[model samples]
Target: MRVRQAKRDQLVAEGVTPYPVTVPTTHSLAQVRADWGHLAAGAESGAEVAVAGRVIFVRNTGKLCFATLQAGDGTQLQVMLSAAVVGADDLGRWKSLVDLGDHVFVRGEVIASRRGELSVMADSWRMASKALRPLPVLHKELSEEQRVRRRYVDLIVRPEARQMVRDRAAVTRAIREVMHARGYLEVETPTLQTVHGGANARPFITHLNAFDLPVTLRIALELHLKRAVVGGIDRVYEIGRIFRNEGIDSSHSPEFTMLEAYEAYGDQESMAELTRELVLAAADALGSRQVAHEQETIDLDAPWSWLPFYDGLSVALGENVSTSTGSDRLRELGKEHGLDLDDDFGPQKMAMELFEALVEPGLIQPTFVCDYPAIAQPLARPHRSSPGLIEAWDLIIGGTERATAFSELIDPQIQRQRLVEQSAAAAAGDEEAMAIDEDFLQALEQGAPPMGGLGLGIDRVMMLLTGAGIRETILFPFVRPQV
Candidate 1:
């Protein structure tokens, strides 16, 4: 740190612009390597190339110096500087005024060293920016809470840290390609919502200053996209930020990207096909149809299991779990599993607790747990054949729920009743319960066609694909304020 500061002071004393407003370069280090591949060892490429990047490593000798530079895209290059060519005065400035992390532009000729490593032999250089503080040593690991606090510096030091971003971009592009090919028009929905009725999650509240009305950051993107369906935007999808005032963990973030898709004249079966296709597309984007995670290679090409929720729970518990299952039996099962179930815990909630405890962890392989209880899925239409079960499924992968889909409840009467029940739950002190949105109910009255909607947790999918933590997939994850 002191060395860098002294260099900055020396540059200031030299009457040099330590941080120039504009610094032009002809090549990124990556482009240089790719374009100059025809040049061989013991050959001088007759090209005068300009490259700008941060000085990552520097070694100084009497008349010769070598520095490693990294560009904004994380491309690294080796640079050789000689006083004989660049002149004594400029060499003096380079040695005394340049520091690691300083952005420097180098005009150079490409050459391979006797050792056969490609490098740039520089004739001239200039500082673009003089970095004041040193970066943290986080290439191996972040020591404490610095992972979220200093992600910029961390990305520079860690290669995979930046690659996660690139991989995620590729994943997104692949998804967009598939969605576009399938005729799903990408759409945007408002992040700030009036009633925040879409999913069951507590919302971040804020007051709209102009209107002086309380609004909430949207917890999901379902309600408005369905309105678009009502208006004849038949096939639609949104890759957007979903905010939830929830606990932070490896699998949860307060704000994260979500992919919500809806297609008219579709149901859980149609969504299942789209969901599988999307996941397969993501795998292909990452250069494989399967990815290795948690010491297991998940086979994307393998047939996906479609298990009814009750059957999965029953298989895990060795006890019958169905709509006919008694509350006393559920209570006994919950107690047997050491779950916190009380009189207030209804049959559906008890089933959820038991499945989450017993079945979810074992679903390390990809599986679709379907037929959620109607009472538990207010947004799902009741199954055609099953009177009390909703046609819904949660795609579970690597032992975590990755996506949720349902045959959407479109009847205005039924939708209104569900929202009213949700509002009642909210009034009874469930912060994560939905509030009635009269406008959406009105849209329902306008005759929304039967549609299937799926919400995929983007961060979680990236985590599975890239083998990164949920926060690692996020460019800047939230952290508590440091004291």
Candidate 2:
């Protein structure tokens, strides 16, 4: 509403359009911040700067007024104006036309305020964009629920929220840099596929008008990244999005970012080592290897502990928790744990429930739970020494499953059989069962190299780095649709 009025007033009085189609920028917030002290120390001669940002706060002292502006790159600058330079009429005009949340370009010189605050003394300013609605004033009183409900407002009021997101961006950049340095080529893959074959999760379905068929959003990037390995990319990675139609919780999002990487001739051990290194690198980028989250400190330095899956489960449960036990015994154990295990929740599923419900939550330290049950790892190669186990590992940190990796199953026949089993499960009413992908099996037949594959939750990593709760880390976590 204010934007329309501003445009009309600009045209009527100044003969200028409020919204100019184009504007060129010479410098960023980072550059100016870097040279801030030098600029402040310099003589107040003819230093002119063109800066654009949203007006965050305002203060008026009769003749002189100050407003805080925030640029896109997470930098804040205080803008000052004096009636001696701006003229009484122009100052009144600014006060009438400008509002909080308005984007404006200012021509200014750097100076220090009476309180020794660095400020940009403005000679002139013009509107870049005008906001229609008033931003919610969250600083005064806001609940956690309200903050989540109005995240954009929360971002405006909470400087910590902005800082945490910036930290997340820094972590992502560090991940890319480390991967590039390690010779991994980043690639993109299809998000909507005919078959969601990678992970055990229900997928969101959508229709493709162009293809004239229904397609499911990908649940994981594992299958396609491995296909890139088959296409002869020695080391490949994808930082992408995945959709899972499931319950909302402290740890899960319906649509989330995933980081999946595959390296040829690498095993679960190699992937576990890389996971530790990458996580540590991210922590270092955040300025410390020590991060405290949820009442505990996590040291991401080096040499994370590795425990065999059965052993870790046993340690957590105070008893031997092995899937190698007979099917009947596994069912009995599941029943003891109050898990309704029938022929439908097969021996493998029963064992998995016992481990997940009774064991996973106890792995608070950074530990790799290695060697999963064969039935638990559909895409992992079988362990050579343990016939019933697969060479897969899950990295557990702060009692959360942060990442999972494995030596990939490259045998086409074995891959096909496992997929068939999943298909049967789906037919038998397991909605989260992986779909059989014939094309993926064909690609496997064409020969994918023995490779280590990893799928890491980037948001979970951010949660660890920022010491933020789950919803706090995400910009707009999914909520129930309003009636």
Best by TM-score: 1
lDDT of 2 at 287: 96
lDDT of 1 by residue, 1-483 (tens): 788878877777878778889877888899988987666676688788998889898898899899999987888888889998899888988888877788899998888766666688999999999999876543457753575678887778877778888899998998899999999999999998889878889999999999999999999999999999999999999999999999999889999999999999999999999999998898888898777867588887999999899999998778777988877899888777777677887788888888888999888778999988877678999899988899999999988898999999999998898999999999999999999999999999999999999988888889888778888889998888887
Best by lDDT: 1
lDDT of each: 0.88, 0.80
**lDDT of model 1, residue 227:** 96
Which tens-of-lDDT digit does each residue in 56-172 have in candidate 2?
888777888888888765588888888888788867767767777777777777676666666778888877776666666635766888778888877876787788788888888
RMSD of 1: 1.6
Candidate 2: C-alpha RMSD after superposition:
3.1
So what's the TM-score on candidate 2? 0.89
Clash pairs for candidate 2: none
